[model samples]
Target: METNATTNENLNMYEKAENYTKTSLELIKLKTVSATADVLSTLTSRIAVGAVVAFFTLFLNIGLSLWIGKELGEYYYGFFALAVFYLLVAVILHKTQHKLIKTPIGNMIVSSILKESKN
Candidate 1:
């Protein structure tokens, strides 16, 4: 009777351990899913906004070039002027690329991941 009782207790403990392990795995899986979902949603929204902004800028540039051409009385000269302006801007951006782009983007990604972890 004593041996039987001891065996039963051990079996009960084994079952509890197994249950705890399974629960822990499920919790991890849930957190992983939540974090993945958060990142994907953020990316989707950013892409949508970027698309809208790009189109807006393109149309705005076209309008400005047309107006400049009208003022100067030659369409291609206006485009040439705009192109020069863009080249200057591109050069400036290239010079400051790391400071203007990389650090901020890295910070944003880290913040997003940390924020998701908190949730």
Candidate 2:
């Protein structure tokens, strides 16, 4: 009888431990899902805003190029100048991309994840 009671107690303890582990795992899964959703939402918003800005920039550049062409009496020259400007900007961005963009973005993402974990 004494041995049976001891064995039953051990079984109960094991079951409780298993239950705790399962609950902890579920909580981790939920946190992962929440963090992923938050990141996706942020990225979606950024992409949408970026698309709008790009659309506006395209029209603005065309207007400016045409204006420049009118001023210079050469439409092609205006477009050429705009192209050159963009090329220079692209080069600069390529050279400084890690410093100017990637690190900041990475840090923001990490911080966001950490903040979610804290909450």
Tell me the TM-score of each prediction against the true structure. Answer: 0.82, 0.96
Ten contiguous residues with the weakest lDDT in model 2: 69-78
What C-alpha lDDT values do all the predictions have? 0.89, 0.94
Query: In lDDT terms, how accurate is model 1?
Result: 0.89
Q: How well does candidate 1 score on lDDT at residue 36?
A: 77
lDDT of 1 at 42: 83
TM-score of 1: 0.82
| lDDT of candidate 2 over 8-87, digit per residue (tens) | 99999999999999999999999999998898899899999999999999999999999888888999778888999999
Question: Where does candidate 2 stray beyond 4 Å?
Answer: none
Query: How do the residues 1-39 of candidate 1 rate in per-residue lDDT, one tens digit apiece?
Result: 999999999999999999999999998888778777877
In candidate 1, how many Å is residue 72 off?
2.7
Clashes of 1: 0
Would you list the clashing residue pairs of candidate 2? none
**Residue 117 CA displacement from its true place in model 2, Å:** 1.3
